[model samples]
Structures are given as C-alpha cells and as structure tokens.
Target: MSEAGKANKARSGGRSGGRAARRTLRTTRDFRMLPGLTRNIPYCEVMDEAHVERLDNASMNILENVGVHFRDPIALEDWKTAGAKVVGERVFLDRGLVRELIRTIPAEFTYHARNPANNVRLGGPHSIFVPMTGAPFLRDLDNVRRNPMLEDLATFHKLAHMLPALHSTAHHIVEPYDHPISQRHLRITYSSMMHSDKMFMGMTTSPKNAEDVMEMCAILFGEDYLEDHPVTTGNCNGNSPLVWDETMLGAMRAFCRRNQPVLCSPFVLGGANTPASVPAAVAQLNAEALSALAYTQVIRKGCPAIYGHYLSTVSMRSGAPMAGTPEIGLMNFMIGQMARHYGVPWRTSGSLGGAKTFDAQAGYESASTLSAVIHAGANYIWHAAGWNEAGMHCSIAKFVVDAVQCAMAHRLGEGPKWDDFDQALSAVPDVGPGGHYLGHPHTQENFQSAFFMPELFDNNSIEQWVADGEKEITERALNHARNLLSEYQQPMLDVARDEALRDYIARREREIPAASELNQSY
Candidate 1:
C-alpha cells in the first residue's frame, strides 16, 4: 500500500474516547472522496449540426486565411518546417494540417496522482472538479478581504484536499502575495505537494519554473515514473486576439516535452478580446485553441492536451467582465459542441460570480454558471469553488458552499439511475394509489441512496432553525470548513524524497533572481 493509504487507514482505525470524542469522530467522517465521475447523460447542445459545421468552417477560415501570431521564434520555425506559411511571426496553417495534427492527440488520458487511488481520467465521459486559481485576494474566515499570505494558500490547499467533491488541488488557489514573485511558484508547488496527494497543476509562470516543477515531480513520483505517466498539468492561456506569446509557448514546450498534459486555453473577454457576438467570439477562441493544441503536437506528437477557454461577457455600460451571464452559458454550450466535434476533451470555468460577499447575488450567479457547465458536458471543471468578485477574491465561506454545490452537480452529471426502476415501482404497488410510501419496504431498503441529501443546506422548520440559533448558510459553511480543517491529516510522503524536494527548493531559491530583478510578471 502507499504511505498515504496506510496513514489514512490508521487514522480511520483510531479508538473512540468519550461522548465529545465520539461527536468529533462522527462530524469528521465526511472524508469519502468520490472518484472522477463518468457521465451517462447526453450532452446539451445549443447548436444544430449545420450550425456546428458553420462554426468549424469559420474557425478553419480564420486559421487558413487570417492566420495566428506565433510570437516565439522556435514556434515560428517549427511551423515553417512543417510547411505552414510563416510570415515573420504570423503562421498561416492549412486546414488539412491542423486537422491531421490534432488527430494524433489521445481522446482520453489518465492523470496519475501520488496515491494511485486518486488518479483521474480526463476525456471521453469522465469529469473532475478543480478549485479556483489565480485569485490575488482572499475573503478570509473572518470575512475580511485582504491580500493572501503563504499561510492562506496552504489553508485552501488543505480545504481542497478534504473536500470530497474537489478532485484536484489546482496550484495557487490564491496568489501568495506576501511571497516574492520570483520564488512564489516554488512555495506554491511545495504546498500543493505536501497538503494533498491528488493530481495538481504545475507552475507555468516561466519555463525555468516549469522545469523546476517537473524536477520536483520526478523526486516525488520518481524520474522513471514521470517518463511514462503524466502526473501534473500545465495551463497555457493564449494572449487572445489570435496570438500565442513566447511566455505561454515556452511553458507549453516545457510540459509537452516532458509528456505532460497542457491546457491550451484562451482568456476571452467578449468585445474586448474578440468580436462581441457570441458565435464570432467562439470561432476566434476555437481557432486560437486549435493553434495551440496543434503546436503541442508539434512540440511532441501524441502529447496529451485539453481544449479550454475562460469565457466571460463584458458589460458595455460598466466595462467590467460579467460572470454567470446568459452569454457566458451560451458560449460554454457552443465550446463543448466544438470540442466534441473535434473529438477532444474540453474544460470550462465553474461557479464564478462577481459578488463581493457570499450573499444572494453570489449564490444566484454561481448556481447559474454551475448548472450551465454541468449540462454543457465540460470534462474538466476549473474554478469549481471560492470564486467571487469577478475573480478578484477567493472567499472561505463561499468556498465551502461552492464545494457542496459541486457535489450536487456531480450527482446531476451522473444522470438518473434507471436500474432500480422496477424496485422503485414495487413501492407503488405496496402503497395504494392514494397511500404514502414512507413505510414501504422498498423505501426502507433504498431511501438513503434514492435522494441526494446535502449536508450543508438547511431545510428545517423556522422554529427549529431559530431555536438552533438561526445561523445563515455562510455561517454554517464556515463552521463546516473549521470542522474539516480540525480533522485534516497530512498525507504521507517518503522521508528521503521530502527532504530532496525541500533541498531542491532551497537551492533554486538561491539561484533564481529576486522579484525586483525579474523582468516578467508571473
């Protein structure tokens, strides 16, 4: 058994103490982490076959005629060697080449985790939830918004680890502002490794940082294991308006060469980054993503990659990016269709909101976005928790609530269980037409699995709620988070390997330039 498996087994086998100890044990028994879901339901398509074909033709036209900018000289040369028409930085691709290149990508790939049991498959009907990343500020336990510290980042990592619905502890849950930018990636990668045994994202701020992450992975999973298995993911977002810059290209090359999966995502703000029309914006994003995905094959043919984008509509009146808007949901449906049309796994944003607090607006907007992604058949759901204030702040209270919502959505994605229809109908006969089934034998046998009873939501009577202090959803979620943290047990790692990782971090910290000396922003 793995060290993490043995440790978790020993913890679960602890002897009980007094009544208080028994209560603590019962409260913290929520450590059942479900594996990545295999969705049985059909995808929700917003466009007809004709519409999808039209969008693909438009994307192909953009790639062939208009062309995309390849800012990296190496990328330009690769295209030039591949018979693409390269004019300086712009590379005009033939429709057949792009199609043939992407055909080599695997439809599904297993993302290995430290504990083998945590490994998740990406592509096909598989889906996994990952927490929000890149938030700069945090709405902490006390509900005060401020710049996050290293401690705050580690806290979110632990929360993500304990949350059963969350499958990956996506690196940099929030920016560790207190740390130096030059070395923050090192600490972020370390925290993710130490806090959770799940698969995580690699540091892609710079190619050097990305290489450092790969080395650390080698130390943890062994150099030989990494050569055959993909353990970490790298997210490379295109600098939109049909451009792939050097920074992102470098990161993609670093991970692709190592046989790791890269998410070729475009950060799209409608009207600002692309045309305001939803179809036009999707065509542009699809073209940009295809360009990057095709480039990954150029870096290493058969390298795992995901079709991804962050879609948000702009408020013309306020000039702010709008989350959970109808346009955003429409874009998600269209993107899912395109990804399926091209036979590739795709990713979409999750539970995003613009509310400053975990209020009605936050709940409504998050629900709107979550429902859309669940129905849209997104394979990898990012920002599944704690996203608020238009990606400005990550909220602790919101994080807990959003995780529960993810659990509900996960159940929805699995579709209905018709295998028990006969047994369910037996209850109908057991009780007369006008009778109740509360006491039926079938109800007694299957009541627990029949319905998804959410632990965080309160459906009690008003008097009972008031008698129990009448706490709101935010307070309940905060309390649940506290309980989960109090019971968190660190996953085990090899003592020698742990030391080696720390030594590598310390050595790199001394070698890397200081934040002031660095020329690029992370």
Candidate 2:
C-alpha cells in the first residue's frame, strides 16, 4: 500500500470510533440512456466495450480530419517533426497517431487533498471532488462594493481549509500581495504546500504560469514520486475551441510524461461558442476530446486524462451564462455517459444555483444539478458549492447548503439494497400486517441505523415550521454554515511547519516585482 493509503486507513479506523460503519451502497441497475433531455442528443453509450470502440474511432476522426491548431511556434515544429500536418500554426493529427497515444494512457490515479482525510481516488470506478473558493475575493455581505484588495490569500486559504466537501481547492482568487506574472503560479504552489495536501494545478490560458506552478510541485514531491504514486497533482481547463495553442500543448505534454491527470473543461456557451441546438453542443464536446486526447497521447503514450464538459446556457436577453439551467444539468448527465463510453474518466459542474438572493432557486438548482451528476456517475465534480452569478462569486451560506446536498447525493448514490434491509419478513414474525413496528425490537434495531436521514430537511408539519420561526431552507442553511464555521478548528499544522510556510511566501513575495510595478512604463 502507498503511504497515503496507510495514513487513510489509520485515520478511518480512529474516526469510526469503534462503531461498525455502514457499508457503501452499490447498485445492480443497468445504465439507461436518457434522450431529448437536452437538444444535445448524446449518441447513447455507456461503459460497454462496443461503445469504447466507437469513441476511439470518433477521436481518431477528430485527430485526422478536424485537426487542432497550435499557436506556439515550438509546439508547431514539434508536431511537424512527429509527422503531423502543420499548416501555418495548425497541427493536423492522423488517426493512427491518436490510437497509439490513447493506448498509452493510464486508466486510474489518486489525488491527495490538503486534508489527508479528504484525498480522493480519481479513476477506475466513479468518484467526485467538489469545487470551492474561486472568486476574485471573499465578498463582504454587508457592503455590495467589490474590492479586489479586500481579502488576503491566507483568508481564502483558511476558508478552503474549512470546507468539508471541497476535496481540492483551486487558487482562491487573485491576491493583491503577489506579482501578476508569477502571482497565479506562486499562489497555487503556496496554497498546495501550505493549506492543501493535494492540488489542482494549471491555468487555462497561461502556459508559463502552468510550468512554474508545476515545477514547484515537482520540486516538493520529487519527480520520481510524481511518476510512481502520481497522487499529488492534476491539470485543468485547456478550454474547448479544442485547439491546443503551443503553450497549452507543451504543458500537457510535460504533465502527461509524469503520468499526472489533466482535465478538459470545455466551457460551451450555448448560443455563442456552439450551435444553439443541444446536438451541436455535444459536437463541441467531441471537439474538446479531439484536442485533449491528441495532446495526452503525444506528450506521453497513454497519459491519464478526464473528459470534462460545462454547458452553461447563455441568456439571450442578459448575454450571461445561465449556470442553473436545466440544459446544464442534462448536459452534465450526457457528458458522463460520453466519457464512460470512451473508457476515460469524466467530471462536471455541481451545486451552482443561479439565484441572486441565496434563496430557494439556489437550493433547488444546486441540488437538482448535483443529483443528476452524482446519479450519472461523474468521476470529478467542480463548483460543487459556494458559487453565484455563474462563478463570479462564492457565498459561504450557499457553500454550506451545497455541502450537505453533496453528502446527501453521496448517500443516495449508494442506492437502496438488501444489505441495507437487514431483517427478513420471517425474522419479524411478531409484527403482523398493519401492526405498529415503532416500538418493536426490529424497529429499534434498524430505524436510526438503516437510513441516511438528514438533520436540516424538515419533515415536520407546517405548524412546527411556523412555531420554529418559519425558517426557510436558506435560513437553515445559513445557520448550518455559521455553526460549521464556528465549530471547525483549523486542521493541524505544526508551529515549525507554519513558520516555514510563512517565511517561504514572504521570501518569494520580496523577490518578485509587484503587479503594478511590472506593468508600469519606465
């Protein structure tokens, strides 16, 4: 077993507190194809052998016919030497090359979250990690005024540290104290080393930033550790339009060589980037696969990669992405099915309700979208909670509510089963038809133990609600968030380690020029 595995096992044992833990629920229900849910008619395919073959062929077509464009000269030249068709900046890949690349990718890997207890397994069977803390700055609820300089990076770091559902925290917004050029890279490395046990590294548009941040990680974990255990890292958001600009392709190749995971977050704005129809949206997803798959294969034979699709609808009236739209939820389901068909891991967005006031719309939208992804079996889930205005803000109240929903989804995914149904009809002979089971031995034995009942969901009468101050879900969720925040102690970091981390950040800050200074005209 790996060191992480041993540590997790030891932790789990102590955490169980001598109580026999409930067995994880599993389902035997065959995967079903849901149609017309979105205009994007997913070519219905699940994790079947034939479906995998079809996906392989489709990817090859993308590589051969609809080739990817690389903006970087070095990346373009590398592809040219590899026998790819380079037209100006475009690299047209062949079907055979794509197949060879796909064959070399690994099927499974592990990811370590900052909290050792929160580490996740990324491939093989489906599992998920939710997003947290990715806004400009922590919003002060009282003052509506937006200030980029308000919250420090450490504050965002602590907030991420406190969130239970967030297995990995991305750089929590840009900080004022850091350099613009090196700010992102510095923040990612510092956050990962100081606050998190595991990390998601890479910026979608910045190749230099990705290189610097990943280099820091390689230094910390050692290159051999990255290649062997390969649990410490992953890359994200080489966005769709599916062309790998030279910089992104270079990063993908380098990360792939180390056997690190990469995410293809194709942000498809319905009417703009894609066709207005759903099928057209899915075709855009195919475009994402073409670029990401080719990059993965070229960098290292069979590097681990995930197929991620975020289909946020653009409101024609407002001209903003509608995150909580039903189409978004349905697209998440379809994307999971598509990724499974290709025999690759998949991820989707979650718990993002479009409500401005943190009300029922937020709760309903977040729950519904999250439920669909969980049921559809997505391997990784971003924006799991605490998002508002389509990723422009993070609400602590919303995050708390979403975390509970995530827990509920995890329970629901376990599904109803016989092991969960302990007592047989014959064993409960005394409880005759319509007889009260409430006071019976079997009832006492199973009632609390059998179900994963939630504490906040009020199943009480309206009279009870009225008597208890007529609190809505948001009110209850806010209360829960406050309680959790108050109750949550910082995860243990030794004094020496803490000082070392602080010193490291301070030293780095002094070395790099300020964001303003770098841009100033001499």
Q: How close is candidate 1 to the true structure, as a TM-score?
A: 0.93
After the best TM-score superposition of candidate 1, give how far the Cα of residue 5 lies from its true spot, in angstroms.
Answer: 49
Best candidate per TM-score, number?
1
TM agreement with the true structure for every prediction? 0.93, 0.79
Candidate 2 TM-score, C-alpha based: 0.79
lDDT of 2: 0.59
Q: Which ranges in model 1 have alpha carbons more than 4 Å from their true place?
A: 1-28, 516-522
Every candidate's lDDT:
0.89, 0.59
lDDT by residue (475-498, candidate 1, tens digit) is: 998888888888899999889999
| Model 2: CA > 4 A from native | 1-62, 113-117, 137-165, 173-185, 196-205, 215-223, 232-235, 238-240, 250-254, 420-428, 494-504, 516-522
Q: What RMSD value applies to candidate 1? A: 8.0
